[model samples]
Target: MPETTLRTTGIDHLVLYVGDIGRSKKFYLDVLGMSVAHESPRHLFLACGGQGFALFEPRDGASPETDRDLNHVAFSVDAGTYEEIKAHLEAHGLEVTGRRGDDRCIYFRDPDGHRLQLVVPD
Candidate 1:
């Protein structure tokens, strides 16, 4: 028999079940500036750097609160890009909070109450 093992390539996408897809779409696309890969009434897929993130409406009875585990997810960008992105987000009325070490980051919350962050890699 051939080797039976798990071959991992890389993360294809991260999905978030939000209370409102429209709101999540705006946050991920407009505020965070992720490029849209696909969009539907109930879902939005965005390209974040080389990775991807999908936001969709939660099923009935599903609690969006469970997304607390995903409280934040960040993309690594050039150290110089942080300020630019931060300025853009702020200009659009997004609030940013938190920074530490040589790495600078911006923090904000999505419409469904999920926290997100963007970090500039060292």
Candidate 2:
């Protein structure tokens, strides 16, 4: 008999524990322009295509804080969409942190202080 089991589903959501929920929400919702599925003063969940992402305040005494790193959550856009997204994000006054001229990746940071990168996949 075949083993009875449940196949794992894709990512339900990516939870980002931040120092400030409000600031993180603004960056994801306003800066990145992701639609909000659920939101509150303490937490905010946004739709990222089929998956989702949740931003909330960090728990007490989780870990000692340090400077943000280059490793960040990445989004893949159409290669054609790079210029358009870049222009739109810049117009909103968000600085593109790491820009690769040859390759197609635009990097930035969220308000609660997390790095993010958008790449136009070849």
Candidate 3:
């Protein structure tokens, strides 16, 4: 018998727990230009068209910088925006890395130390 698989269109949303919802919200809004789709006392949902993400207040003392788990979120951008994105991140005092200059993606971290990436569409 074959294993069953659940079909899905794509990622509808993503959630990230942050030490401070306001700080995280500001970072995403200011850096990525993500407008708030919804807001609550301890959560802010930023709309990214079909897909969006939420910044939620941390519980039980979760540490952002000390977390050893290696996870990152990548956002797709236009080819022309690749350089502009890199420049924007740098202008914001973010430490951006591409591993190699030829790489189609640049990696950086948010104020909460959450890894983020910007990749150009193929």
Candidate 4:
């Protein structure tokens, strides 16, 4: 076997298909504290911890669907701020789920139904 020479860097951004870009933008910016990098009628770009996420509204007026094969997107958070983050999300009426096997992470869904996670180092 020959050694591969191709190399790739980390994730540049994540694009999520949302039903309503405005609603999704509000949820991300207001709840998650993400900053707006760019936006349009059908798209919104959010910046989180230097990474970017694009919320795209489909033209067909269909709701966004999650792929059961892929679980969720996990964002890294400081261990000290974990409780505060949980509380903030809960305060916004978002249901936070704790994994049975992991105590250092919590899961929740965005307004568009995309699953997301906040995780701290063990």
Give one digit per residue, the lDDT tens place, for model 2 in 39-62. 887678899878898876656736
Between prediction 1 and prediction 4, the one with superior TM-score is: 4
List candidate 1 segments past 4 Å from native: 1-4, 61-63, 78-81
**Candidate 3, backbone clash total:** 0
Task: State in Å the error of residue 79, model 4.
Answer: 6.5
- Supply the TM-score for candidate 2: 0.73
Q: What is the C-alpha RMSD of each candidate to the true structure, in Å?
A: 3.1, 3.8, 2.7, 2.6
Better of 1 and 3 by lDDT: 3
lDDT of 4 by residue, 1-116 (tens): 66789766777788888888888888988987789999988988888887888888878786666654257888886544566777888999999988534567889998767889
lDDT of 3 by residue, 1-122 (tens): 66669667898889877788888888888988789999998889999756888887766666654276348988877545567777888898999988435668889988878888887654
TM-score quality measure for candidate 4: 0.82
Q: lDDT winner among the candidates?
A: 4
Off by over 4 Å in 4: 1-6, 67-69, 99-103
Per-residue lDDT, model 1, residue 91, is 85
User: What C-alpha root-mean-square deviation, in Å, does candidate 2 show against the real structure?
Assistant: 3.8
Residue pairs with backbone overlap in model 2: none
TM-score for every candidate vs. truth?
A: 0.77, 0.73, 0.80, 0.82
